[model samples]
Target: MISILFAVLTALSNGTASVLQRRAAADAPEEDALRLSLLRDLLRKGIWIGGIAMSAVAAVCQAVALATGPIAIVQPIFVIELPFTLLLGGLLFHGSFPRSVWLAVAAVAGGLSLFLLAAAPSGGDASVTTGFWPEALLVTGLFLAALLAVGLRVRGNARAATLGLAAACGYALTAATMKDAMARLDHGVGAFFTGWQLYATAAIGAGSLFVLQNALQAGSLAASQPMLSIGDALISTCYGVTLFSESLRTGWWLVPQLAALALVLAGCIGLSRSPLADGLAPRPDDRPRTDVPAAV
Candidate 1:
């Protein structure tokens, strides 16, 4: 029960942190295009690093959640990050938003709530269980890693989207593996880093996450973020249902989860294309950090 709560909150925090970091990234300044090196360096130092750090924290929280729940039940719920990002965007950044955006957020949130209401909470003992898919997962992870490496090294517009999607798949893979490791553990922190599998799991998860951050920093924040967010959910959903044994409740309620997914995709689209995504540009997102009032 406590684990479930942690998983849910971790999703929320991860999402919120992304939005906040987006705002920071948007505010970063580039004084010269010709001197791309200096300008890019400055922007990375001032904003990108902070944003990336927050995302790392989110990932750690996510790992904590995976230790408690199955990937299927936990991963989709992580989609909650998108709307929470929006909420954090609005509240912290003074970002001007349309009612439709808020509606989209609400729809996704409501859908997840409905889905959780139907789904049973994960309560299995920590014993590191992998169903029938270990070989498949290993194979897929290697393919994805190769794909991402090639995508990052290559140069083309098509390659950009390809890389984004590949990296997204990689992230999903990491999350799934992390969940597996957590399940394999014995009750406490003692088991946390004791096994080779857990360490490998954490490395893959964290490494892919860094790739995700690099993707964000390397190119269009708007283009990459939405695609990544959507892809994470889809890939994770597939893994969850097949690999994690996260069964969806039958009938009537299925529509709501489906609806929620639609809402999540829609919101990601809306946010990415939004004029307000200027918050995600290289400008300071409007909101206070502590003593200073950003809007004032």
Candidate 2:
């Protein structure tokens, strides 16, 4: 119960921070991008840096949650964050969500819960060996390469989704590293290159977030967010299982996971179909334009 509550609070904080950061990014003048102001550019400093600081706090809380809770329990409850994210955009940013989006969110929530229920218990003890480094790094490299290539080839919302997927890969690999870090906390691996995994995790986690916000800032949140949620959950879950030794009880567990994946796909599709979107149109705006004759 405590762990779950902590996860909820963390997710809420995370969502709020994400929305604020996105808004700030959306409104920022490109000329002043992260520049140190001549005088006291308190607004710039606060909007950019402060939002990031709050996100850092949320990240720490999330890391703690992952360190303590079962992946199944933690990941599903974290999915509530997707709804909360859209809710934040609606309330604070004046963004409106369509009915189908709500339905998809509801479907995703239900499916994710069922997925968790069908999974094995995982909150006991986690220990990972340094021997797995080769396998972990190889898989991480593969995900990185695939996502990067996909991100480059795509445009607009699809590009954003690919970038988010890349970020997820980084984050999940970092989670695996964190597990290794936790294992080496008391060891003398600190003075030299003994705890590469720990620092690698921190670097990956932090870097991925930076990339995530940049990707979000490049396009519509509705278009980008579903991918973020689904990708993050999948990456984190796989990290738990593959690198951190988390597991499922039975083969039947795959069924719920696939069902949840379908729900996630539906949610993404619903978000894409929103009236707020420009549809398959190239431009970001949905306003009807007067058809002007081409120059002779």
Candidate 3:
């Protein structure tokens, strides 16, 4: 129960942070998007600072949740972050929250509950084999590099969605690595530093932030949020099963799980179309202009 509570709190913190961070990043001076210049500019914004603080809180809460619960259980719970973002973003922007969005939120809640209860994920090892480490690192690194390359080549909503998915992949890999490193805390602080997962988590986390900033800068929240939410859920589930050796109910139970996935997807789609999501995008006048003045 404590783990569940912490996961929920983590979702709240992360959701609110997304809105704050994007607001600051969107207002930053035009530059190479997601470059150090944009980051330096956003660092001066109070809202961005508050967003970073919230993200830190979320990370702490997530670590606590992971320590106490299976990765499958803790990570899937983060799907609620999208709905929470819609709620908080609406409140922050004074936008009217729609009934359909609430219905979608309720569907997500019910679907997650039904899916988790049916799946009953269990069994995980605290330590990964040495050989597995190289494989895991290589696969994740290749995937992220491909995603970044493709995302950087796009523009507008497509760019946002692609970069958001890349961020999601980074976040999923980070969570898996973080779980591995945190498990070493049982041995002592020295053990944690000795583990390569700790370093990988830091590197991936920094990359995720860079990708996320570009995602936000590329387009509206609607373009990024659904991709980020859905991609994280899918990748994290695979990581939990593969890396942690966690098991979910198979055979007959797969049907309900599939249905639950459909429900979650539907909810995410609905919320992405909400007024609150629209508000998250910069106003037309606020967008960076590329038009040069007419030659005098």
Candidate 4:
């Protein structure tokens, strides 16, 4: 239960960060995408910095959640971030959502709840076996590379979706490594520091952030958020099962899980089609008054 609570916090923090970062990324020059210059430009924006701060908070919460519970349980909770992002975007941008958006949000929530209830993921080892690392890393690396190649070749929504999925994979790998590193803490401080997984987590997380920025820059949140949220959840579930040996309800339970996934997919499609997903406009009163004199 504590893990679930922390996972929710992680989702909240991540949702807020996504909105802020999306705002900043939308204004960035297209030429800067997938380049270091993108981050350099973002660093100059107060909003982007704020987003990074929130991401740091999310990382802390996620670490605690992963350390305490099965990654399958902790990671899937992040699917709520999609709805949270939409809701937060409305509030921050002074926009209102319609009834359809509300219904879609409900569907996403309900589906996630159903899936978790049906799957009942549990009983994972704290640390992954050493032998699994090389194969996992190699496969993950190739998958990311292929995605990045496709992302670079595409434009608009396609580019955004491709890059978003790539980023999701990177994030899943980061979580897996982070969990492995955290397990080292049980041994000693020296073990935690010496563990290669700690370094791997840091490297992978930073790369994921870079890819996410590119995704935001390529198109509207409507095009990318679903891929990011859903891909991460599914990929992390695989990592939990294969690497950590987590258990889930099987046999007839798969029926409910598939149905729940369809519900979530439908909700995602609905939310993506809503006007709010394209970026909400500020209320008339919230707009800057150009008629006002400068303070200087």
In order, candidate lDDTs are 0.60, 0.63, 0.84, 0.92
Residue-level lDDT of model 3, residues 1-296, one tens digit each, is 88789989988898989999888777764455868887878887788999999999999998888888878888888899998887887877666777998998998888888889889888887656566778877898898889889877778889889999999998998888888899999999999999888998888888898889888878888888778877887898888898889999999999999899889888888888888788775677755566966343
What value does the lDDT take at residue 66 in candidate 2? Answer: 63
lDDT tens string, model 2, 5-114?
A: 76677678766766666665554333332233311232444555666776677667766766677554565466666677766666654456678768866776777666
lDDT of 4 by residue, 198-273 (tens): 9999999999999999999998888889999999999999999999999999999999999999999999999888
* Pairs that collide, model 4: none
**Candidate 2 RMSD to the real structure:** 7.3
Runs in model 3 with CA error above 4 Å?
A: 284-296
Kindly provide the TM-score of model 3 when superposed on the true structure, using C-alpha atoms.
0.93
User: Candidate 1 at residue 239, lDDT?
Assistant: 72
- Cα displacement (angstroms), candidate 4, residue 267, comes to 1.0
The model with the greatest lDDT is 4
RMSD of each: 6.2, 7.3, 4.1, 2.3
Q: Which window of ten consecutive residues has the lowest lDDT sum in model 4?
A: 279-288
Which portions of model 2 show Cα errors greater than 4 Å?
27-45, 97-99, 121-125, 186-194, 275-296
Best of the two (2, 3) by TM-score: 3
Please tell me which predicted candidate would have the highest TM-score against the true structure.
4
* Alpha carbon lDDT at 42, candidate 4: 92
Residue pair clashes in candidate 2: none
* lDDT value for model 4: 0.92
